[model samples]
Target chain A: MVNYLAGLDAVFLALADPTRRGMIERLSRGPATVGELGRPFAMTKPAITKHVRTLEQVGLVRRERIGRIHRCTLAPEAMRDAEEWIERHRRFWKSSLDRLTRHVESGDKLTLALTEERDE
Target chain B: MVNYLAGLDAVFLALADPTRRGMIERLSRGPATVGELGRPFAMTKPAITKHVRTLEQVGLVRRERIGRIHRCTLAPEAMRDAEEWIERHRRFWKSSLDRLTRHVESGDKLTLALTEERDE
Candidate 1:
């Protein structure tokens, strides 16, 4: 459980940056060399490399050296845990809201009955 | 676009902490008083308050005062933007993988044709 939380921490921290999110977006199209990933950004090569490193640390991207070029591809499965975490909460909240809706729709008869029992 | 990214940044940062995530989980079940929210953790009231503040900053929870007590409830809608952001990328990666599978299944005919055309 601790390790799971740590993984979530890393994933969320890695995704906190817009530059990193943009890199993921580009990688989603297909794989690309470091230079290609850096092209769309105004930052220097080292700066882009730093962002890529953060993503790699969180397992969001996998890098391979092909000749002198470093190619990066989206590690889609790394996102599964984070996606599932969010989805679980989303479903929970949705169901909670549904329950709340039903309670409200049922009106105050239950509340009144409980109050009467307490008074007795 | 910038504002949207900022929202994501805040949401992810807020979620990066396990304590905050735990509080969110509790809130998922129902509304709770500030004291109730702090009961499960070993942290001080101020520490818990700090976590709650971060969550509120991201609109993840809504707090209201009933007399001297503060009631906090999960603001599930606040999660909508973050959920959508992750879902979009998740869908993109899934489709990209599907395309890759099709390309590999089709074999090297396209690759050979491209190479021959380049040579000609």
Candidate 2:
């Protein structure tokens, strides 16, 4: 789980750059050949290729050759992993806040109750 | 939006380190003084202070000094931003796959229809 979170952080950071994120947004519509992916950017194909390679390293995108053209597609599973981890922990915070709210209103140990509920 | 996404990437990356993530996990249970937050790690308090400072920079935590004790609490909002962004795009991928599955089964332009569905 620890390593997985680190990988997710790497993937998202790789995607964080404008060029890389643009490549992904373009690829999302359909698979794109490397040259096609590069046309929108002012940078050279090699530069874009490096970005794609970084994305590939983090498992956010995959490349395959059809004839001489290398096509890229979104790798959705890693995105899902990141989403699920964030959602799980965010809910933990939300529930904690909710219990705090209830306790403040009613003068009760609602926080304790919520923890006990989780214990079951 | 682009800058916001970049910030999200930075924040998550900052949180990726084990010591940093450990600080967050502990903070989630309750607020902790800086010295208390550093006890689990073998590193010096200055090193741990640096980690906590990084977390604070990314808005994952807030530090408040009550007397000499610097207490840190989970910020929570930044985590929500990262979670929401990941979840929004992940659902996009899942729906794309579902459309692909249907198209493959029915031999129709389900992908096209899905794109059109988004247009509405």
Candidate 3:
């Protein structure tokens, strides 16, 4: 599980680049051959291929070798683990805030009393 | 707006570090003074301070100067924009999948008909 998170870290890090994000966006529409995907880029084929490899390592994109061409498609579940991680912490924050709200409303009388007793 | 996204890129990139993530997780519980926060780490105060500054730059943490000490607190909304960016594309993917599902279920009759007409 921790190893999976580390993989997601690489995915997120790879996606931190505009070019990579653009590539993913394009892939989302449908699978495309490597050269077709590279048409819009000013970068060299090797550079684009490297980017694609990084995406594949993270499972954000999967490449299929059909005949002489490599076709790439989006992998929707690539970021699912990262989303789950954020969601897990989101629940924690939500619960903490809920508790804080209740405590604020009730003035946390027990804690206040303990502090007062300590002061004396 | 793009500049804001770039800021979030730096924020996410900064957070890609494990040490930085640990610092954030600790800060989330509550605010802590610099020395207090650095106690668990083998790293120096300057190193910790640099990490905190990176977090501060991304608005993930805020530092308060109280006399000679600095207190750092988590900034919850710092990642909100990044979340929103992900959400915006999430909807697109959802819609695209929905359309694909519908097309599959309907056997894409219209597309087939159009292709047949083109062939004729």
Question: Each prediction's DockQ?
Answer: 0.36, 0.22, 0.19
lDDT for each residue of candidate 3 in A6-100, tens digit (9 for 90 to 100): 76568558767766777766666655566666666789999888888888888878786756778576776766665554455444555545644
Say which prediction, candidate 2 or candidate 3, comes out ahead on DockQ. Answer: 2
On a 0 to 100 scale, what is the lDDT of residue A113 in model 3?
A: 22
Interface RMSD for all numbered candidates: 6.0, 6.3, 6.7
lDDT of candidate 3 over B12-98, digit per residue (tens): 576566666666666555456666666667898899888888888888777767567675666757766655555555556665556
CAPRI class of candidate 3: incorrect
TM-score of chain A of 1: 0.78
Ranking 1 against 3 by DockQ, winner: 1
Per-residue alpha-carbon lDDT of candidate 1 for residues A69-111, written as tens digits (9 for 90 to 100): 6767788677777778777787789776665456547875434
Residue range A2-118, candidate 2, lDDT tens digits: 344567667656755768767766666655667777777799878988988988898988887756767676776877666666666666676655644565478546334333322
Alpha carbon deviation, residue A118, candidate 3 (Å): 19
Worst 10 residues of 3 chain A by lDDT: A111-120
- Per TM-score, the best of the predicted structures is 1
Candidates 2 and 3 compared: the better one by lDDT is 2
The lDDT leader among the candidates is 1
Where is model 1 more than 4 Å wrong at Cα? A1-4, A98-120, B1-4, B98-120
Against the true structure, what is each candidate's TM-score? Answer: 0.79, 0.73, 0.72
- Scanning candidate 2 chain A in windows of ten residues, the lowest lDDT window is A111-120
Model 2: residues >4 Å from true position, as ranges? A1-6, A95-120, B1-6, B98-120
Compared with the true structure, all predictions reach lDDT values of 0.74, 0.68, 0.63
